[model samples]
Target: MSGPRGSLVGQQLRVATTRFAHGGHAVARDDDGRVVFVRHALPAEVVQVRVTRGKAGDRFVFADVEAVETANPHRVTPPCQYAGPGGCGGCDLQHADLGYQRELKAQVVAEQLSRLAGIERDVLVEPVPGDVDGLRWRTRVEFAVDREGRAGLRPFHTRDVLPIDDCLIAAEPIIDSGVLRRRWPAQRAVDVIAPSGSGSAADSESDPGSDPGSHPGSPAAVLVPVPGGVKQAPEVTEHVASGPWSGDITVDARGFWQVHPGAASTFLDHVLGELDPQPGERALDLYAGVGLFARALADLVGDEGAVLAVESDERAVVAGERDTARVEQLEWRAERVEQALEPLIDGGDEVDLVVLDPPRAGAGAPVIRQIAQLSPRAIAYVACDPAALARDLATLADAGYELDTLRAFDAFPMTHHVECIAICRPSSAIRG
Candidate 1:
């Protein structure tokens, strides 16, 4: 309940603009010094809001949407059910028009680089193409268990569970899971293992619908990272993929993922298309999880090509390695991709290319330095959070690499979330 700035109990003001944070919201001021955070608001929006929480000297104020006095022309209606009840926090930009959403996201990238990373000049590449459906793409999701033996999503910033009628963004089968209705408030964790017909109690009821049906011959499960307070933790976990292309992908019920399956594939296709891997090239896949692109990269490298699949989560890395055996030369090691650079790049390995598919926060400083020091011939970076991406880009560019390709993709249709992939190469290329 403590917000940035002073105590604003009675402050009333009109919000001028909406920016994406936890989600899309309008910004406003209460008197001087203190800023207010409002949800369901847009830029150039006029509305009176009451202060819900406040803090002093920090930054902004946080408040719920009261009313809309003036609205921006770009604002549009959201289509997803449970979009606001807090059940489906999946789509954050639904209220904004598609084109307008792209513009706001672009601004976010630029600001993060300049303001946080301290890099002033950057070519904010045009956003990658966007998808329209914004729903039914999620392969992994964790839900809550209520007293009524029912499960659903908890409200944002609160533990109040709102049972879902249906999740538009969930893969068709998972959405129809009886698990959604049968609340299993285990005092322990639930593990859904990959490759069906395994021996487990949950497996008995998993049914055909629960199977993600991902990639062929891929082992390992998509273990949902739930909090540590269920009663009995299960022995085996499951890896859920929307399609038959599985490798082990996990998502906390509230964590972020591409809302469009086709879009994820599209981005993957772009990476595969551009890199054009040669047989002998060894790649460093930073922040690699579930080894999506890592797997594809390993394949391209063939028997001669080795991929150093680095990830922070030990389980995920193990799973990724186990699954990547399909490609022969792929190796998995558990380490914070953003933090571990010195030891990994200590001269033993000759990594020709570097790839990073980071989460929303983007890559911190350490990994960025390695990419520079190793000075790979090419670096492919996939980012969900534009601000963090911009910040990291500033670091890489200053380290002497030149930005060669910049493309953005809009995977989350309704929300402000967008994905961008950039390709960087050495400052000087050898002339043929």
Candidate 2:
């Protein structure tokens, strides 16, 4: 296919990958020295790539590995039959060993930090506690419904849905729900959530029958979206145990909860460890979905201190308020973090600690600057995108906050997605 200058849409080229880049692509230079981002490839591997996107004038082109002439030692056969080129685009590194997947993820985080934030540091991606061999860890999945009424996942960068029987990364309950078996001609997609909590927090403390489908081995909830309207999702309880703290938080089934079973508890441990919220200290939990950090902070800070949580999702705020109603020190605000921060900043309300768990697009510059202005003793940033994290870290540095420590976790296995918890402190604290 040819365009104004030259489009490499269907062109084939043989290139040797040089290194791993962000977004799960391997960097390689074609004969013309134009950069090519090859998917399903590894560093130092020679592979045949088919250009999927880009033009001659573009700085880089996106390609898929058509054939591997020389495979890397870490390369392994993909467990899923629909994980390769022109197949399901849900997973990226399924062809590589699980351990190697973490190594590549670490490299990507380090590269993003160096390139975007001008901070060079070796990063290690640790595996979360929950998955076995990086399989069946996804507690929630939304499958798209095709024209034929079949449920499946879409390919990378396309809306075309490919029907599949199973997803290796999905939790067993999600598959057991028989979501793919049923056909929905009127619905666009189906969302399934399998709460992995054994109800250690809810079941032991309260009646086991309080929350249905959230018991130790209950079936997953299959939600078929109503056409032209929202689905009134049921409330599901999630239990988190970290350090000396263990409790349950109720969230809307379709709300923002960690898809990885171990992600919430693991991140809570790290965040608490990073910012040791002392008694009589104020804290802020931005983008606090169901007040996960707020509850923990309020527990440690006690009634003498305060913890304010801001979440744009009204449903999440309502649930959080209801669940944590006994904690008098914790406050819930149903507003965007940026907007909420504005009032706090203008009112000169300084917090001793801050926890930022923004969406995939990071907190951006404005929010970072606002948070930095609060001059929190310590800030914990939980980021899912390294590139976005790096950009915000740069802004934080400019605002006189320095990175104290960073820990990366392979929260989403099989895919290139990695979670990073970055701890930042004021320049004065670092200097001391």
Candidate 3:
């Protein structure tokens, strides 16, 4: 399958993969010494990869494993029919065993930390509770609608919708909702949410999954994009039982929440454990969504201490405020993290602990420097992308903070996504 080495856009090359890389690709060098990011292949396996993107002169060419001349011992038949080279792009490591999937994710995290942050650490991807086989854990699924009104998922690197009858990663209630069985005539996509709790009897009796508000936990269900504009989606009740905290938080279904069922509680446990909030200790929760961490911090801080939760989305702040009305110590500020940090920095406001769950991009240098000025006793950084986390950690290091403890979670199994929580402390605060 090898053609001229100068152009490899559509060429096929058999190469031996050396190691696993981020974004669900394996590392391999072609005959011409150009790096090939091969999908659907494992390390040390010789596979023929068909270049899907990039030309010869590029640093690396994207390719899909066309034929595996040699396969890894951990390779197993994919549970989903649509998980191979040309199938659905939702899952990346379905071919590998669940344990191996976690191993690969851990390697990615460690590699990113070592390369980007110069921090050499062995990362173990821990499985959240109730993750038996890395399937049926997704509480939220977005089904893309094809031109013919069929709901399905899209392939990677393209807008073409692949019609699928079922998504194995979705929770049982979502599939029971018969979302894929129906048709969307004029919609582009359908957003489905299945909360952890069970719906009420009336919600159960109604047309299940079709009506967003019909199910008890399934709030803002079946969000369809229409011409005139969709109505205000209803709020969903999510119960958190992490550590000593157990309470119900109401958030809009369309709002930002972890897609995995156990992700929120898992992250919360680690955050609370790392920060170890004490009474009369002030704290800050940046990019707080529905006050997940803020509420927990407020409870631990008691009446004398205050906790500020800043979020760019006003709606989220309003929802968080309404849900935590009794907590007088918690204050929700509807503004950007940068905007909130400016006032705190300018007024010489010092915080005892800081928990920031930044987006995939991670908190950049500006925000990292600003937070460093506060000089919190400890900072908990919850991140979805390891590369971004490593970069931000580097910035924090430059600002007199050292990487204390880092933990990675296999929250999004079968995919390249791995959640990481890094605890950074001021250099002088690190105990020998």
Models 1 onward score TM values of: 0.76, 0.93, 0.93
Which candidate, 1 or 2, has the higher TM-score?
A: 2
Ranking by lDDT: 2, 3, 1
Model 1 bad stretches (over 4 Å): 1-6, 9-12, 18-23, 56-58, 85-90, 114-132, 185-259, 338-344, 429-432
lDDT of each: 0.60, 0.87, 0.85
> What are the per-residue Cα lDDT tens digits for candidate 3 across 156-179?
778999998888998876666666
Ranking by TM-score: 2, 3, 1
Candidate 2 per-residue lDDT over residues 1-432, each given as its tens digit: 455568779899999999999999999999889899999999999999999999877889999999999999999999999999999999999999999999999999999999999999999999999998999999989898888878899998899999999999998887876667667566677777776443211111112333324333445544434333675766777889999477988877778999999999999998998898899999999999998899999999998999999999999999898888888999999998889999888999898999999999999999999999998999999999999999999999999999999999999999999999999999899999
Native-vs-model 3 lDDT? Answer: 0.85
Total clashes, candidate 1? 39
Top-TM-score structure, candidate number: 2
Q: Which ten residues in a row have the lowest lDDT in candidate 2?
A: 198-207
Q: Which ranges of candidate 3 are over 4 A from the true structure? A: 1-7, 198-231
